[model samples]
Target: MWRCALPPLHRYPTVDELAARAAALAVRSSGDVRLRRVGVSRAGTPLWLLSVGRGARQALVVAGPHANEPVGGATVLRLAERVLADPRLTAGADATWNLLLCLDPDGLRRNEGWLNGPYTLGRYFRHFFRPGFLEQPEWLPDGADGAALPETRALLRLQDELKPFFQCSLHGVDVGGAFVELTRDLPGLCRRVAHAAARLGIPLELGPYDTLYWPRLGPAVYRIPPPCPRDLAAAITEAAVESTWYHPQRHGTVTAVVEAPMWGVTAVADGSPPADRDGALRTVSHALRRDARVLERVLARVRPHLDGVPDAARLLAPVDDYLLVCPGLADAWDPDTADPLRPLPPLSTAHLTALRIAGGRIAVRTAGLLHQLVTRAGRDPAGALPELDALIDGWCAGYRDDCGARWIPVARQAEYQARVVLAAFHLAGARSGESDWGSQPVVPMHRE
Candidate 1:
């Protein structure tokens, strides 16, 4: 039987908050959930691992690699707790599971205030435009002379020591959809995972990143695309590809990668909520349970094939495209390309056409505001939140028309828009009455 004691939605834990919760839970269950500090993050934050059901062979699941996407971290921690709370479910599992719950502490912390802090609505808006990548501590590679970031070095050491049979690094795509990759064959397993996700009410759609969501149209909207494969590998860069499972097929240790949909804990019509707590928890909890069930079934079926997976020793021609997209951030958001987060300058004719290309309903006023904020955001986000939020609301309201052929499912899209709105609200709450920079007082910057 399920314990049913999980916290309500209002109390859903953020990445750091979950760490303390996981640590406490591990301590309480001393024999079941063993907590270990495997490494320190680039910011010297402890990278925690919670182990359950000890066995000879091991499997690893890591989350929070990028930080802002902390749902996977929270999900893994909850899964660990569930495992400890219910041993029979995880008992006799051929492989022991080692979960790295929150791989990117530095990135997680920077946005912590967005969920927990208090301020006026105005402050929250300005804070939303903060450039996460530029502030990401993990991306700062090793200095030429001698040293790598302590966190990076520690992770390398752990990989050498543990040599996990399977590795799953979890992250979220703002756009809705799901995708999975394995170095070699894991047919029955991937399909089973999809089946379980469907049972939990998540969409079964899987594809490359570009095909996952319809392209943007105007303010606060996206287009839904027809069925297609979204190249997720081509989306982000420097993401431990050399060390993940695909590394062999290309050159890495990560064996499997799965991209989950972008929905939040609750349901929202556009992006605002009824502010219901229990309802959201019930929905999300069911999803998590379903995910676990899927993973369990798939692992059982795939164990026999693990030994036969193509080894690094195989001689094969290098696939250029896979190699090009393996760099995590580079693949996701190319620095040289037009920044997705940044919009065109307000009132500019070119700005209108860009929004038109993105597709859906066209709102001249909303588009102009969002365009200005995104443009100014490239320079100063703290000054742009309020305007951003107003723009976001407009976009959210116009989602149906504005969403172009991007594949964001209707339900998940509402959830994502709500999360984005809440995120904007949090940023708007960062400060009160503002100081002067230009003629216009700074308003919330909502990207819609």
Candidate 2:
């Protein structure tokens, strides 16, 4: 009864359309799946949380804190539809399902252009919009008061109100294949999750993004590295992070971060040494460094163009500051630091790495936003805006030339993430029952 198939995702729905569709679905459904507006976005858009089934236990699944990551939105919709039609699909679930699709509507609205059609790299970057990391809902402040988005506050309240048994924060990437994050090492469950990802046809990002500095649990899944002690405060709302923010001592909660790429790179899926030796790892590291430089240069050029052009400074400055933090994302892959039997670092990949693709995506957005800034300046034939545009144009061209990625179907990625959610939920059921999924053949998950 576990349905992993997703609707066609060649195109995406606008925020308004997606919200309306969700609302309409709720209205038409009678018994189990009930939807309510949990909170409102700063832009006044309604944020709905759909509840399915009646049970004491609960599972919280959130998607799309970042507007550009629309794959999560697709995943949640399919899941809700599937669970509503057949509540038994949740078979042994002792919990209720609280599914939230697209928590950040204002940011998603800013990305409207690339949402509907043409899920291509160029179009996506051109219309991309993600807020600074500190401003994101998942990382909202817990201690010394700091600025927080309304969407963040809403989720915090929800997390506090209904501390669930499992949390699956669905996310997506653009460059590499797929990667996962779990709160701790549950090898059997990890394998189950990995197998579900394999069915989606994308390889695991052996060299994952963001884990370069953190400890990893397996080839593709990494442990949720701890933040400073301040993050554990009682008010930190759902653990201050989507993966580890549930309860005291994790209190019977399990979480996973499922990130899939838009493009399929052989290196991302492969675990063996490249024919060119460590060339692939180097290629990935070099890309990150190059991306950092591109972002720095783009930020410099766009700074001067922002005066009196209707929210230009407010829109661009924080993003500019955030880009500056990209350079230090990873340390150079030192073979000395690699595991003794492993040819590369524990998390290193052969061909395309997640950080490489992630860096390229970020650089493209930085350049694209700079171009937007220039365009907003009207006809500046003789000003710095035109010169800046010209520079960013070259970066954009170079980015496309470098990636040369074939955009995979979004539905495939969504299906994979959704299936992982299902896998995690099943794992939760097993956990509460105090058992494992028994033994199964380990799928040779990576090609090398």
Candidate 3:
């Protein structure tokens, strides 16, 4: 009985490190661990599909589906080992597990610089590499000779071929506690999944309800939310739901994505009673307007400087347009209904600071990318990069000053995420069986 100790969770596993871990599992399992080369990345990195456990129902787990959210890969690797350490964990269950670890390796490679080091707020924000919305794997264009990366093509083929009955991809956000997005509304599944997460000490995200058009499944669970991918993507991106949603040519299947916070901000789940409800709602509305204005002002400030940058009109919109997008999509629920999501948590002073740090970092990175693009395209004949660090630095310094930040261990984030999903997968595995064998095997995994 061997349990792999989780590394520091604040940092993520490198692509090579995770790949080697997968190969090592195969060796330890005496050839039972089957490694499939789903496809090769653009940079020649092998995209691996690790197949372990045996059962009737097919389950596919995509980790690191979004390159910027790297912790999913670590969580998947941990879950994979969990499944392997005890064969009976899946014995007599319905699921045969398959995982695509780091589906976008090129993007993963690009983000390697920030994975291991300086896991500081500024370091993460400045170093993070988020592809333009269209280039993201979740919404990659599938047309002939489209700008799709090599890895996207491989995933399309694998998904179409496997036609999995259950599919999900792992994702996490830079701030906030855990939340889930479901393709369908199953209250029973929600209770089970949410409770599982709670036992792990992971709080449900009860922040501002920004998902206005989607069905609120549970406390933090939103179902088939809209402001759909195409809503924002159409203007600046070629992203569409047809490409984004899991359609294995079947019905009665469920797909889920869980976003875990990189750090613990206890304020995310504050459902405390309030004295003045109307005033609270007014404050919330005021905050939304303020955020929108701030974004607009920033965009205005940067507009003139963007002239030398290419695609300035199309791509740069999201840089500040995200403000408009978010406000337009704010939680517009009537106060009469059980509007629990609205009153759950006030953005703490510290949380707001962290959120600003994320926003500011993203803004700086956006400008930095534009600077790189303009120079690389020879739009800037002098090869000069746009100046942004000083502006970003100034804001970060202010953020640090009245700062109330907490650095939750990377292990806790990964464990809370892994345990909940493991419980859900175990539940799915049990759904295919007649009797419940879940209660017994988990102890060994925990204490052995």
Candidate 4:
């Protein structure tokens, strides 16, 4: 019996390197891997497309859409290989494939070296210190033009052209477990994936209250206490929740996106069972096979709705507000480790005030201050701040029961120390809405 080998999938690659790799695979597999330029990176580097297999239909899978969360890039590369080698996977009766792998080259290049480094225990932990997007090779808009980023443009173009039957964007969070967020209901698919995890000895926490394995997009994936439905995308889009993704076409198709947690995969791959590099690879291989089965089952059951699903973006506002409020504060209830990497801290008074002010201006209603804090923090994290290094380290140490630090269960820890710093930033932003931080000038501090 051949066991799968775990390859170092965390390593990030530059646009050129990724393109070359895709190109190489395409060459090796001949028609199995077709290389073409989808778009250029923000920095003007070419982003390549790799398509394998044959079918009348197409499925577009994108990885590394964000600059920071990049586990999907590796997953895509592996999936590409599998599709090329396994004729059964692509040539079956309903087979079709058009994989769009690694959209944000600029983001990946910034930390590519660290991403590709050794996969020892120490190396894994060391990755937390790698710099964020300020060092990224990608160009980010100045909040004026979101998705103005070139990579996003290419992605939108692909969506316009392929109008795929299935669409998934691969993203990973520091904490949280694996979960799939469908554009629409894929009940059997979720069950298949969940069962696959269980079979692999990976923990499976489904249904509401499974914060570690929740999705914000579809209904019924995350159940807040008392059975409240928490749809991340729907919550964000209160103004309209009826039609989203691509306008529902009468003769249209369904798009399925998988929001897999990097840590969840890693924990399953390298947890107490001690899955080394090779073991992790095998786990991934098995997991993908299960994913295929789930997708096939779901497709067989649900007819695609031609009308586009509702674009529920308004619901995300409160969640985004809560995330901006603190670091690691939101992770107090996760059943996972104390600190996997990025944890949401509590919201500061400044952030609360900002939310209040913004809400009042927009006539939006929200829960009481404390409840808002807990609920918003509970949602998946949107982003993080820089000063969280020490707190994260301490939490990680606590997970291992280090002698120097007191450990708290992830769901139990109080707000993070970074909350104070975030509050300060909010205060700074609020005080001088127009002035830069340096110009507004807060007092400097010296360490004792």
Most TM-score-accurate candidate: 2
> How well does model 4 score by local distance difference test?
0.38
TM-score-better candidate, 3 vs 4:
3
lDDT (tens digit, per residue) of candidate 3 on 1-448:
5554434334688889878888877667655467789998877999999877766566678888777688888777777777767665555454567888888877777677678876665566555566555556665344423537677787777777766656777887665467777676544556765665566666566542333235677776777543233465243322235544445435335677777766445555665545655454444445444555654554555555656565555455435444544443234311333256544334333233333334443444554444444443555443233344554454445434423334445666666667666655555545545426465556433411
Q: Mark the regions of model 3 whose C-alpha exceeds 4 Å error after superposition.
A: 2-10, 140-147, 186-201, 208-212, 225-230, 233-240, 249-251, 272-387, 390-405, 430-441, 444-448
Question: How well does candidate 1 score on lDDT at residue 84?
Answer: 57
On residues 1-448, what C-alpha lDDT tens digit does candidate 1 reach at each position? 3343445223224666767777776666646678899988765788888877676445566666655455566556545644555433245333466778776676566446443434222222222222222223223322212225555555555655676545565655433344444443332344344443444455433223232233432221222222223333422222321232332222223254545554321111122222543343333334333333432343333333334333211101111222223233222222233246752122222222222222211122222223333443344323343444565454444332433213333233223322322222122222111211122333332121
Q: What is the lDDT of candidate 1?
A: 0.40
Quantify all predictions' global Cα lDDT against the true fold. Answer: 0.40, 0.63, 0.59, 0.38
Q: Give me the displacement of residue 85 in model 3, in angstroms.
A: 1.5
Give the least accurate 10-residue stretch of model 1, judged by summed lDDT: 312-321
lDDT of 1 at 50: 80
User: lDDT per residue, candidate 4, 1-448, as tens digits?
Assistant: 1112333333444456566667767776746568888888767877677777666555566666655456655556656655554444455423455556676665566444346555222233333222222222122222213445566567666766776555555544333334444444443454444443444333222221123223333221321211123343323222112222332222254434343433322222212222243332233334333333432333222213212323222222332343332222222222232254644233222222222222221111111111222233443132221212332333344323421112112111101111111122222223333223223333321111
Q: Compared to the true structure, candidate 3 yields what TM-score? A: 0.74
TM-score of 1: 0.51
**Backbone Cα, N, C clashes tallied per candidate:** 80, 7, 3, 42
lDDT of 4 at 68: 48
Error of 2 at 255 (Å): 1.8
